[model samples]
Target: MDTASTNHSPHLHVLHDVLTAATYEASSAMSVWTGGKISLTLDCVREVPLESISEEFDLGMEPLTMVVLTIDGDAGGTMILTFDEENGRGLAASLFKQEVSTDPEWTETEKSALMETGNILGCAYFNAIARLVQAEFVPSPPAFLQDYGPCVLEQALMLQAQCSYDVLICQTTFLKGEEKLNWHILFIPNPKIGDALQSAQ
Candidate 1:
């Protein structure tokens, strides 16, 4: 496979359209909630080598909360969305209007909100693709990780290992008020799906 050229797969165009729609939706939602406008930037989407995925984990510490949405295809890979604990808490506090104390009892609520927020954003993106491709796609229930450290990477690695050497990574940034939130969306296509995408071009 020509990895270099595949990096710019046509699927990226579809991905971009979905991201644009999602950004609009995210901005509208945030504006209504915060009384401030929100904007989003599409950072990048590319084919990432497996080794690099491991390196990213080594550089970052966990007790990270990540959400994974799996796509079933011959090219199966995990899509992960990551956020900082402090940022996550801040957003939750702003939305709920309650102090998000570090109490374990309230952890569930915090986790739920995080997952729900991701779902809304993901749906906006995924729904766009579904419309463009004229196919129905369903994302799995989100999986949450509260532990900080290499464990976060472990989960990602486990998910990636089920597929090939390359996975599509989509990076996005959301700005609300003066704060910026980073979102990373991975598209791991199984062998067949990957070949399909590659063949389309």
Candidate 2:
């Protein structure tokens, strides 16, 4: 499992295709689920050293909400859905058909709604992975956290960090009513899966 030290297969194009397709599905699914109320535009998916994730998201010390789901079966890793407190509440309000609140504390109802939203998004990408790789990719029950984005990301990366110092992250920006909402989805691929993806090419 020492993926960091192992020599990776020279199959960049194939790996790129896999990431591209999966991310596209994730964005599309989100759009459909929102009934076009929210539109998602994604930047290119990129792999960077784990330490850089905090800076990549500009995750300062401010508290934010994060939902995590673990991918199992083939290449195992985690997926993170993040939203700042304001946007998180806004999303929850929209889901519940209620007005957005300014309260910083999340009620139980809001937390549940956010977790379900995460599950939907996570399943979209997992479905793409399963279809492309022709292998079972099961997503675990979602876990919710409210903390500094960087702090929450550190927890998400802790297990993956054991096998590799680098991780793959894809960022998607969500727009509502022509205004971009502060929401992001990050995909962290397991090193073994990373190897599989490249070698499959």
Candidate 3:
């Protein structure tokens, strides 16, 4: 988490800026929601190799709770937000002003809370990208998954193969005060959106 990385591909410079701005917006929205200043740590925004994603994220076979949002229109691809159970329950508890649930099964309210959080964060992220690329980007409702991190990520990568190999890695860890939370966001933009970003740059 301390190491910072960047891709020097001139083709990716504009894209990095777009994703960075999106993270900033997401941080602001989170701060407003919590009534306390919160920020997302952007260690690097780069084009990550598909094959290296598992190693890069240290995903291994660990089960993680994640949200996936598919995007369509002028831009395309999917966005994934991942966090462990502790972080997920803690976040929901904060928003709902209730104790974190100890149950293994997610209740209807818990699912709704987490998905809504994903919607807020995804909207903030896509809004920035749309502004930079000057294109329409529509995000579908979030789908929650509890499975091996690498498995979910692999499915996402397979979907990306249909469009382009340009997978953008925007590594962020949510921060409340000085404490780092186990939240991360990963997204891949299809060629259509990639082209728009390059042209805009």
Best by TM-score: 3
How would you encode candidate 1's per-residue C-alpha lDDT over 129-152 as one tens digit per residue?
555545577877777655653455
lDDT of candidate 3 at residue 128, scale 0 to 100: 84
lDDT of each: 0.57, 0.71, 0.76
Which wins on lDDT, candidate 2 or candidate 3?
A: 3
- lDDT of residue 182 for candidate 3: 82
- Per-residue error for 187 in candidate 2, Å, reads 0.7
Residue by residue across 18-72, what tens digits does model 2's lDDT show? Answer: 5566656766666676666875655545666877777777877887789999976
- The list of candidate 1 runs beyond 4 A from truth reads 1-7, 30-38, 55-59, 74-78, 148-163, 182-201
Error of 1 at 53 (Å): 2.2
lDDT of 2 at 142: 94
Error of 2 at 62 (Å): 0.3
Error of 1 at 69 (Å): 3.3
- State, as a TM-score between 0 and 1, how close model 2 is to the true structure: 0.83
